[model samples]
Target: MGLAVGAGAAGLAIGGGAGIAGGVALGRARERRTADAVASGDGIHQPGITTPVQDHLHFAAFDMMARTTRDDVASLLQDWTYAANRMMQGLEVSATGAVGGSPEAPPDDTGEALGLPASNLTITFGFGPSLFDERFGLAAQRPAGLERLPAFLGDDLDPERSDGDLCIQACADDPQVAVHAIRNLSRIAFGRARIRWSQLGFGRTSKTTSDQATPRNLFGFKDGTANILADDAAALDENVWVSASEGPAWLAGGSYLVARRIAMLIETWDRVRLSEQDRIVGRDKARGAPLSGGDEFTAPDFAATDGSGTPRIDARSHVRLAHPDQNGGIRILRRGYNFVDGNTDLGRLNAGLFFLSFQRSPDRYITVQRALATDAMAEYIRHVGSGLWAVPPAPAAGQSIGAGLLGA
Candidate 1:
């Protein structure tokens, strides 16, 4: 079968140009570790909250030639690595603090890597079983197949199956320098080996989810009523980390998952009156707090009856339904970004969100979003972008990833 690409928006998956680009960019996996505790119900769940650094650029490439030799791949990659490292060094000067104070915040080396970070550019790559097949006699097929290799490309894949594969990632504090570096790298490496598909990502902000009480989306209600939590390492490992049983013993070090893109219609959405917008999203427009009551981060009481004895948090209220119980059950881990393009409407805004989330499966997170898409907010938003691909896991210790996969 031919290769397929996809991207995620909130939760839904769209198709076309955005799909192909998102496919190459969105499928990469990495977590921003946090250093503080988040306020949730009774106590708090703080698995060291860290945001996925935005300034870092991410690039994922697939090998088109399923029949190339491993030695050739290694030779080509060696040259690519030298080039990328030098490029990242230069990009760092423009990044937050790399040169001076970041336009945003400079890179914080203190805590773990993903802990609320943003670099000028972050680049990563993944190799399928086909890349390994040329030398090890194995073909990686499904999303799970990447987990068994040893020395996982590290952040996303398992450690047992990462051997004999090409997985490379690099990050810096600059954007313009990063783009030029990658363009140069591609020109040199693209034809050296068989490239299947490739993608690049640029992040403009570090905050993916809004804090409680923060202004919600166009719908007016405090958004993110349903977000997942990560309280400890074990949970993070189980719920967030990829496994190694999917691929060959030598290929167990990787991970894979699909990503999709979505576009929101702010202009059309703005046409509605304030009250209508609030009713649809179920949150206050200015504060993004729960309607009829509750503080930022506080759960809404769904069972409490309204003036006529009807449920205060209506059965259909986005927040109420997302949190059926006072304990808040409708939570999903959200990690999205914002994107803005030039205006085509003469003198108006033309921008939207690049919604992204990581979950065990699409069924849990996406199922809920499907319902919202058909709700009152449907007319104000459209699925204009999409892409899909299995994100290969991070690289392990003592190994310089990308060396083997790129036929370096």
Candidate 2:
């Protein structure tokens, strides 16, 4: 009788575990379907997702607030341009020029020379529930919602995987303003549902010499040759492009994946010439594309040789390693912005990239980046920004706004 009881207990335990696993599998399937529906324009709404109302707020607020409106979107696009531009002036002044791991470590000056600090500094902020649901379009479906999927838990909410409804970002000469802008936005959304938020920056010690900073790795050659290029065009239409045609009608104008990262290491990169730099990076120093290339997506022949008889696709090149073996299998959609700080280490420097990319699966995007991290560029760029989120499906109408799906 005792033996029988033990067998029954084991069966119950196994059944319980299986039940949880089933729930997870179901949730993922639901999430995938929601993305597909929205992409396909199907109009079937998920239970707890948010809507594009927030995106409207972002558009309108910036349209009204900025000094220029003729090209508000254009200006926003411009904000993403250069590394040490006026947009980051505020951050450069207020930033302590400290690395992520050490509070006392000073910013590396060589890093500054290579234009690294011009883009590494960043302060991120997100809206709260109040602003997200009511002020934004995620309001309950009872009277105005479109009805979408339920909110995600840990698995779905992985920062790298999700996107946000609205994003308000700006950089001045000081980091304080960046912090202020983010915090202020959060306040505006506080009374309702809260959005996820965090700040990410850079790290590291100095190699002290330009040779150490040379665009090469310990392997001694230029690197980062085949990185995929990204602008709003690629991100909005090509990559984050989901087909939710089967989703609820209200979710018609939704988008996904607002990824961000803080990549560092500049001093060593400055030692190379502009032309050499272009080859190492696999993009024009100013235009950011292939050296033997056409547009951002145009493929460069790795096997091509340069005038120096060197492999056009340097083995250590960022592009070569990312798309190695002449195989085009790896591709990550990048939507990154640049930042800089000259004030962090008592006005010295700390810089790198504000890495951001989006994809249907974190594994897909992360796998490509992992290759870069281990490639020749690893010594230069270290990942400091990390988070995952479940961009809620567009909101539904006349149900509970962004409730079940968002929190479920």
Candidate 3:
């Protein structure tokens, strides 16, 4: 599909006799509604939140520049809303696109994805707790559930990559599509925001839909075996999406996202025996069956014993502690991806899972993470970065993203 006409053009077309001010307002409203509809899944494009987990991810976090005003931030969001709508539909950022603009000035779009398919690209935006501080006059509107997460045991978080004022999660079947989205968005925010840290990931480790096969992590185990499926509306309402009555009207349909950069001790883990690995994970590496002897989807028999009368699933095994049964039946939607950045200074692979989960509240993650503090697998992984973001709901046909919170 072609890129939507610019608001200025739309205004000029209809403003011939009506005057610029009124026509501009009417044109913007019309263009916004069109953009919102396209993003809301009226066609092939899907909004990021509901979009199926793709093969690649370009996750970025940014801090607002010191001189950017609240109004500037709002304008940026509006621009992003329009640009994202076009990109998701496989079009350029603007009508002039990457190469059609004036020769003297830089192009509006970077053009890396010029001939690529939409590739099921989705761009999701989020707000961090710091954004609601005194800087933007948004403190009063901050959701009670959007608090900063407390440091967890065994967390080796890097200050530079931990938190940010804003976040954008771009996912696509093709890596270039995902990268292009972030690249153009960053360019758009030139004077307003600077990327704090970013991570590129591949090999999704979770299944958001039943049609997809369960994927594996670097540890060679089927991950997210008991994940919350997108088809389960009730489960999502109960665990993933935040409701209006929950508090903070602006965040009624929003969700909280927690991201962790976990670096695996691959060399150490690789040398472990197969049986030992199964015991540590509480599941067979190949079959992904519970150690108690059932299929991948079979309910784990945490109480079962072995031939020697020992607990089949170790008391401190990764699964036992992370299981919902042990954590008040709390479940978060996992959409993690495997990452291999490069080799560490010591010649070890600097690679692991980029853990991403969405839940109704931060407490959901906090509770489960704390329970995993004593997990046997903790020794094989170290958390080097973390972030918490409040992901607002998709825009309606006439609304901009976070319109309720920003009051734009």
| RMSD vs true structure, all candidates | 14.0, 21.4, 6.7
Winner on TM-score (1 vs 2)? 1
Error of 1 at 305 (Å): 3.7
Q: Per-residue alpha-carbon lDDT of model 1 for 1-408, expressed as tens digits? A: 001110111111111001001101000121211111111121111111222233333333434344555554654544443333223223211112122433454331111221221232334444543343435443443333333322111123222312223433333334433445455555445545533332333443233333422223333344444443323344434443334554333223333322233346667777889876766656666765666667655655555666898655445555544442422233334444344555646655555544444433334344445445335555555544432223333222112333223321
Q: Write the per-residue lDDT of candidate 3 for residues 1-408, one digit (tens) a residue.
A: 111211211211111111101000112122332343431122211144434678999999999999788887786777677777667667787777788877777777888988787777767788999999998899998888787789989999998988899999888888998999999888878788989999999999998778889999999999989998866879988998888898687777778899999999999999999999999999999989999887999999999997899999999999999999999999999989999999999999999999999899999999999999999999899999999999876555445567778766
* TM-score of each model, paired residue for residue: 0.55, 0.43, 0.90
Worst 10 residues of 1 by lDDT: 18-27
Candidate 1 wrongly placed segments (more than 4 Å) = 1-52, 55-121, 126-141, 144-185, 192-235, 244-258, 310-332, 344-350, 361-373, 402-408
Error of 2 at 16 (Å): 46
lDDT per residue for candidate 2 within 1-408, as digits (tens), equals 000000111211111111000010011111111110111122232211111000000100111231323233222222221111111222221122223224454331112212222121222222222223433234452212212223321122334322333344333223433344344333323332234444332221111112222132222333333333222344333434334452333222332233444445566566656666655556555544566657544676777777899776567666665673433364444333344545345442455544443343344554555555435555555454444322333222211122223322
Model 3: CA > 4 A from native:
1-36, 39-46
Error of 2 at 247 (Å): 13
